[model samples]
Target chain A: MALNFLIQLLVNGLIIGLLYGVVAMSFVLIYKSSQVVNFAQGEFLLVGAWACWWLLAKFAIPFYLAFLLTLIFMIIFGILVQIIILKPLIGEPIISIIMVTIGLSIFFQAIMNWMFGVFTEPFPTIFNTESIKIFGLNVQTAYLMSGLISIFIMISFALFFKKSRLGLAMRATAFDQQAAQSLGVSIKQVFAAAWAISAMVSAVAGVVFGIVNGISSGIAFMGIKVFPAVILGGLDSVLGAILGGLAIGLLEHIAHYVDVQFLNVGNLIRIAPFYALIIILMIKPYGFFGTKDIERV
Target chain B: MNLKNSRPCGDFRTSYFKDMSMFEDKKGFFLTCFGVFILSCSPLFLDSYLISLLIYIGFYAIAALGLNILVGFTGQISVGHAVFFGFGAFASAWLNNSFLIPVFFCIPLAAILTAFIGLLFGIPAARVKGLYLAIATLAAQFIMEDFFSRASWFTGGVDGASAEPLKIFGIFFDSDTKYFFIVLFWMVVSFIIATNILRTRDGRAFLAVRDHYLSAEMMGINLMKYRILSFGISSFFAGLGGALYGHYLNFVSIEEFNIQLSITFLAMIIIGGLGSIRGSMMGAAFMVLLPEIMDWLTRSLSGTSIDSALSLSEAIPFIKEASIGLVIILFLIFEPNGLAYRWGQIRAWFKLYPFSY
Candidate 1:
């Protein structure tokens, strides 16, 4: 019975971690290429989930079609953000750029609140089937499907970055923007592409997380929550994001369980990832898989 | 001084006494004194609401001064200062309730305790830089807020602690007018200390570190010690502001000091100019007072029926949050040097009047 409970917790952790992994990957992609942490990544996620729900629940579109349309909207929105706001301030200070993103996040959040009207809405799953039992352990159909989808997306992104020309350009830009620009690479276009791809990924994560846990402003806050995951995985490492997400998920689940035995310490579970993030930052400031540069000072 | 290069610029530096003056000139000194005199006497004529608003501004100005020391002079970005403020309020409240200490003593004690905690958090700051240090401070925020909210003993659990009415020299400060005077008095004291600190070696070291850490280090400035001390001093004032705010409101809660407060404080510093002492007062007033004016406009538009304006009020919070975010964005993009630079330009333009290059 204990073993079964542990396995169930592990499965739950993995599913949630995979969701966080998707969000963290979106952040990592933008950071790796632009060296700008998109603080609004979670807001993008919230937008995607709300957009999907509006299409499917309110407009009565099919779930798959709604999903695709949401992805498209997110991509366009991402590109527009890059063009309108970010493109004008390319060589500005990092904090200025960061504040812009934070402002953009607030703007998006306000728009979302105006559109969605501060309510949690249930999103329809693509596969609305019953739970599956694997060796007498029950797993929800939505969880299984979302988990599979997350893995599929992660693997595809890995393969794309390894094989695609655009991906190679992104890598080159991330490595050295001035050098890449000198080598005939259009860094502007690369940044736009990165933003678009990140938005799409955020959309996917948003929809999946909404389906799993419902959607609200709390979901938008997950963007801040995912900071630890991105930092833990190495802000620039895509694979590290995935691994860090899983680790945080497991840690939080265990924290929740462990707190149940103590005196109502469950609230600390929400802060577990940040505590882990601080620890990781103290020990390895650049994170586990990130490249290290000499401190000039 | 060379007459061609430096023409004294009015009465700004006329004599040794004027040069050594805090205002640098007779005109500025008297103008500043007049401003303070007006501010000190404001509560006598203003209504209760305006008096309370001024008190809020005073408290925020003190807190913003602390933040300016960290972000402006020392080049440290703290997104978790609200936690320090909250800790101060909570500590003061706890001491007042449990130990029955006077409000004045409790407030300073709370500031000291919060400073101690700030020092502990500042330890990691020495090793980490940039966003990493920000994350660490953010962790401190979460931990402190969590502890106060969850731990029943310290903070009265989630319900928060009630503050005793403040008393000064046998005079009970129960009215807005009383609170205003108290807050204003401390605001002036805080301003003087903040200004005086800037003229000291430690303050110069902070500016040096901010401008060029390597050069400052090479010049025998200890980065870790100054950085940590900066955090301590900043949090000390933040704690003092929080304590004053609690006493003025006669209550303390977790929501009173949250991440949004920290962000709003940062917005004030950014918009008002990062490194200017005068900017602190202007920034705090702009942030706290502008929102109140907006709220009044909103209330007037809705015909005094809050029930009818529930949706509009719901949008109000989002609007306020968005506006702060927008101000930071617009300022960073256009006026990153802030209001202080504009003030400088205006002063210079007047000083060099009627002369076309």
Candidate 2:
């Protein structure tokens, strides 16, 4: 019986971990291109999920159409934020940049709370079958779909960075701004594009997460949770984020299993990643994939 | 760093002793004295409610001043300051309740305890710098928050902990008006200690570290020691401020210290002026009063069409919350130097009223 429960937890961990990877990927995309530690990354999810839900519930539109509109809306929203708020802070000190992003996060989170109310709202029923049996384990259809979508997104991200013309420009920009500028790449467009793509991708993750769990202010916490994953994977590496997410997810579940079986102490799952983060930082600091920076003092 | 810029028109210092004095001149000294005198006497005329707000402003300013020492002076970023502040609160309450330590003495004792914990967390800071350091502190924030919840003996777990009123000899300070004085005493001392520290060799070392770590290292400043020392000192003041805060409320709850509150502390320092001593106080006062002003504004406008349509009463909590972020962003974008710098600019304008220069 205990083994079955542990397997069930493992499956749950894998699904959620994939979703974490999707969010972490978008987070890394922004950090690599723009060099801003977006405190509002979770707000991106909140905004996107809320936008899609509002469209579906208020406009009574079909799920596919609302999802499309939300993506379009997020793209514009992302661009606008980059151009208006972040652009002004380009040459500012690190502290200034950090404060601005934090400010943006608080402002957006509060505004969302006010508009949507603090209640968790469920997404309209899009999937007819609630759960499907796979390998003798019960899995929610939404979880399975989220898992598939996350994989699809990851593959597309790999392709986008490798093959697309804009992706190449972004890579060049991230590599060296002056060299990229000299090579005729516009930094302005690259930044805006990075934010736009990140926002759009996060919206998809947000919508999936909202479908799996009811959408509320609680969903915004994914931004904070991404920290441990990214730190484990390497802050600037896209591939690291995915692996880190899976590891953290499995770690959380295993910790939970231990607590239920022997410790009986609760809330370990919420805090285990932080302990792992501290340990990783102390031992490695650079993580498995992060590039080590050489500073000239 | 240019000493000549801050002095008034004809005030000249002929010796190093004169130059290194806390006040630039007797006039500046007198002005500060006058300001404090007015604040000290405010309790006599102001109501208890107003006095309560002042007490809050006092404690928050003391804490903000500590943050300024770390972020502004030493150039170390911490997102975990609120947890440290919470630790102080819990520590003071526990010391008082467990060992029967006097609340008066518990305040400083709790501060010392928090400084030790700050040093423990500052270990991560010694290894990481900039963004990495910021993330590390964030992890510390979560870890400490969990500790607070799990260790019920210290924080009283979910029930929170109770704190006794401060007593001096046989006098009990429970009222807001009486508590105001204790807060003021601590605030003045904390600011003075900060000012004197900044004027010392150790303080210069902190400035050196912030300006250029490599150069500061070459100049014989121990990079790791100063960074960690700065964290300890910063937490010292954070603990002091938190103790005052807990005793003032007569209770300390785990929920009070979180990421949002930590960000609010960051906002205080940023809005007031990063690295400025007076800016910390000004920023703290501004933050403490911002929500109250919003409440007043909302109350007066409650029956208006826009207010009725938006249901502004229900939105007050959100509006207040949003304003903190708005102010932080606006200040960073438009007034990155903070209100202290702005105040200096205004003073300079008045000093050179007719001249274009």
Candidate 2 stretches with Cα past 4 Å from truth are: B1-14
Q: lDDT values of the candidates?
A: 0.82, 0.91
lDDT of 2: 0.91
| Candidate 1 residue spans exceeding 4 A from truth | B1-21, B296-314
Query: How many angstroms is residue A260 displaced in model 2 relative to the true structure, after the best TM-score fit?
Result: 1.8
**Model 2: which docking level applies?**
medium
True-structure Cα RMSD, model 2: 2.5
Model 1, span A73-171: residue lDDT tens: 999989998888787777776556666787778777877776677878766656656689977889988788779989998999998899999999999
Candidate maximizing TM-score: 2
TM-score of each: 0.94, 0.97
Model 1 lDDT tens row, B309-338 = 556655776666666677777777788888
The CAPRI classification for model 1 reads as medium
